[model samples]
Target: MTRNALPTLTLLSLLAILPCSGCQSSKAEIDRRAQHIAMLADDTLDELDAAVATGDVGDAALSHIASAKSNQHQIKDEADKARTALHGVEDATPWWGRTLGNLAIAGVLIALVILLWQTGIGFVIKRLCYAIGLLIPRSTKASAALDAEAIARRRACPEQRESIAARRASDPAYDAEFVRQKKRKQRDEVSRHALPKEHMEIATS
Candidate 1:
């Protein structure tokens, strides 16, 4: 080849390789996201399965199970589409128009994937957890532990109660005694309205 033609050919070859790399990167990203979605689906499915085994699969839980399965299917379909988009033989097209076009297409595909992940995956996972009413038990346990600690601190340092005051400001359960008294008063009022005075005491007891 002529010296001038050698650099031109090299430049064209480099341009052609760009699309292949982009496609590969896009495919890898899709696979990774798909695997994450699949794992989430599996976790939710396992929860449903456990509920079913225990015969506690209520209507709400069943609905959540269906939703989780739908999410799983959608993720798998997206992964399949991504794989199919990169299915054609590499370097089959000419280096000029086709290479540039492929590069643009790869860029667009990757952008779409990112959009789906940011707006779709996180939102779907949040909705799935909410729909299942999956309130993590650990948080409640932790709060209870905190409340007990606060109570102990209050009793141990009644004269030096700065920490207890701080906790009360920060924690909802800090005013546990007041809440309990208020609830007890409300129940007493309800019982007085609903029953005779003699029966009210028995019912409350």
Candidate 2:
């Protein structure tokens, strides 16, 4: 059987045997046995005493004393055996075995803590570094230079000066190009709608 199955079956067997084992002799039966033994011992003792008290200290009295002594010895022997059996059962237990078992458990827990510290701690630290990096400024010299150039152009251009002085301004180069395009379009329209040479000469005469 598999290791796991073996333990499960063993547990089930123990549980199944519990009820049968628990069905021991009743209290009444135990009490009756105890009373019977006590009565027998008392009778034996009384008979021995009476035989000794009477002047009949003969083979009969001797036999009676021997019988009582044998009974007492048997009872004592049986009690000693029972007590020894109980002690054996108690010593057979695996209670002290848990010391080694608990040490093994503690070793496993320590290994897990070390593993988490080695692997998990680095990952957490890396993530925190990335998050903190995002909040840090990353401005470069090239961008600052471009901004300065745009400001200079806006200051130099006359029409762009006013717009640049407004609450917000476009890049000076862009504003300059826009104004040039507007002037070119206006010149083109004026030339297209101008009077012809003949009309201009008659008007002039």
Candidate 3:
């Protein structure tokens, strides 16, 4: 049998025996039995003494028999009382009580299953979407144009060019500055290396 089945069976057996077990004598019966045994012992002693004095053992035997019968009667009474108590307890627990208890347990189990299902499936779908996005490439042409414009503006400011270039090389935020400085420097170098414009107009009066 499965491990779970063993405990379940054990529980059922215990429940089945509960009614009968409760029908057995309680503390009161046990105490009554003890008292009766004590009394019987004392009576037997007295009868033994009397039998020896009167030279008649029949009286002593009769006394012993009476004590045994009294004990039996007490035991039967205790058993009956216990049975009545058990019956009352069983009556107090209605069928509806058990049904409601079982329903509550089932409801909790169902709720847990639903929560796990949502969490597991939601996590898997999120991962799948992320992986699909990784497979697709996005356009960067707009981003490139923006970088070029920012570089041109930065190159117009000569005082800020060196600082801008250093920042651009080291930090992602300074990328536009570096592009602007580089473009400006290249244009200046080209202009410096080229010939000046010639004067073709007549001298002014």
Candidate 4:
């Protein structure tokens, strides 16, 4: 994703990013880093503008150099969003208060993982993944792989896998694209493997 879009994902990635250190860290580091990058970008932009004014840099060079200002803007925006994240969910809170809340959640998850380690995390993770719809693609692919006789009982005929069908059902635009892709795949198979197409079609159909 673009740097301008990074702030929205900051909280989700925060734990893995900065040292958790009891969640004591503030937005200072994020601000400093982004500001440093923005500062350098601004300096480069100023130099490029000077070069253009002196007729040293051409239109192509100026066009590329103009991107530096946009990059600086994105960096500044990302910093602002990160600093605002502290007060995002609730009103401005004390650092210690936020730390305690994060610690509590972390402690609970850790304790449960330790207690359940004997039971093997595989089953629990699998069940949780399915429950959260993470494994829907795998489920849909398995269904599509079934033989024609077994597939006859199914109600919905899927051209693609998983949630894409639900999307195609809702969006006429996407459905059109889906149909195009299916036709293109058939054309490719026929042209690339004409001799084997007759035998291979039934297995994938």
Candidate 5:
């Protein structure tokens, strides 16, 4: 090789290797962070599971669960922000769409199915015709635990409640519907507690 050629080759090789090495480092960092989040989330959730199983599970337990979920969400947000800073938004997984260009080159049926599911078109269709059956609204019941958790969330996050209150105050249609529902619920409760006809007659007489 010529004397000048040696220096040019070394520079080109370094230029090529540097970006790959940097990418590997970034990938390692991302993996490390994901592991940390997983470990912390697992420990916290296990504790909450035990609480739900054996503990009294009052407002405190519900609060803990809500707090844990909120923390988990925050962890995800931070991870995403860090990744965006490192690799940019385009590198992150697309929220509402998935690419199909790869399918043309190395297409796998399973990968295609998974990608389709990530698309917006697949979402409602999946919900409409999932494994069991058509997933209709109001077809399931909420347990006492779920109800307690919801109440605890409302109590813990006053800001969320304030936002909801603001929305209700702003939207006349929503406010009217909310009032109508509350009145209907109150009427149902009163009807359930009403005395029998004979008992009412005797009491009145």
Candidate 6:
């Protein structure tokens, strides 16, 4: 009687295990599907992040996780549409035709640059560079020579000689050269007046 009860207990245990085996497999399959979905969602989000890093997405798209997810789907959809449109455009345009168009535009731009250079635009550019301090106006040696020449001219000017004469009135020994300049200026003034009178006398005669 004990052996018979043991077999009955074994049979009951088998029945319980057999029912649980199908349920366990179904639960595993559901978990696997959920994990796959989660992995796919993560991949999509990563793609969105890459797009944002490349400046393809704007600030508004990256503000919140929920909105970002929405943006991700929208971006994906738009990209798909763009790809489809691009493919259609490519199909409509011949490869050689596109290449020729690009080459023509590049040639025109090169010709324009050559024309501008030939028209002395380069000189204008050099002048602009000088004005902006990218180029020097004169060499140091040349500038020094020019400054010396200007100083000599300024000192030799008659107006400056008169100014020196005025200084001599305040300081007797200010510039002895002023006395010679004053005498020369007075002689030139007298000669100028005499010339005008001579001219009038000649005209009357």
Residue-pair clashes per candidate, as listed? 0, 0, 1, 0, 0, 0
Model 3 Cα lDDT, one tens digit per residue, 1-205? 3434544544554555455445544545555665666566566656656665775657657677566656656765665565456544423444654555465455545544454455597445544543433322133223333454555445435545555455546643235333444466568756765634222233331
lDDT of each: 0.56, 0.50, 0.51, 0.55, 0.52, 0.53
Q: How should the candidates be ordered by lDDT, best one leading?
A: 1, 4, 6, 5, 3, 2
Model 1 misplaced regions, further than 4 Å: 1-26, 89-205
Give the best candidate by lDDT: 1
Residue by residue across 1-205, what tens digits does model 4's lDDT show? Answer: 3433344344444553344444443455555675676677667667766877898777777767677667766766776666567454433556766675576566555545554553578557755554444544643434333422222334335653455557657644344444544555556556767767766887789
- Residues 99-140 of candidate 2 have per-residue lDDT tens digits of 444544555555445554555874565445434332222342
| Candidate 5 lDDT for residue 125 | 68
**Tens digits of lDDT, candidate 1, 13-43:** 5665566556544445666676676667667
Candidate 4 wrongly placed segments (more than 4 Å)? 1-26, 89-205
Runs of candidate 6 with Cα error greater than 4 angstroms are 1-24, 64-66, 69-205
The most accurate candidate by TM-score is 4
Candidate 2, after superposition: displacement of residue 45 in Å? 1.0
Question: Could you tell me every candidate's TM-score relative to the true structure?
Answer: 0.26, 0.23, 0.22, 0.27, 0.25, 0.21
| Candidate 5 residue lDDT tens string, 1-205 | 3444544544554554444434444455675786677668667767777877786788756877878877876776676566556654234433222232233223343434445565566665654453223342232212222333343334526775565467557644343444444455556556666757658889899
Ten residues in sequence with the least summed lDDT for candidate 2: 134-143
Report the poorest 10 consecutive residues by lDDT, candidate 6: 171-180
What's the distance in Å from true for residue 149, model 4? 99
lDDT for model 5, please: 0.52
As a whole number from 0 to 100, the lDDT of residue 202 in candidate 2 is 93
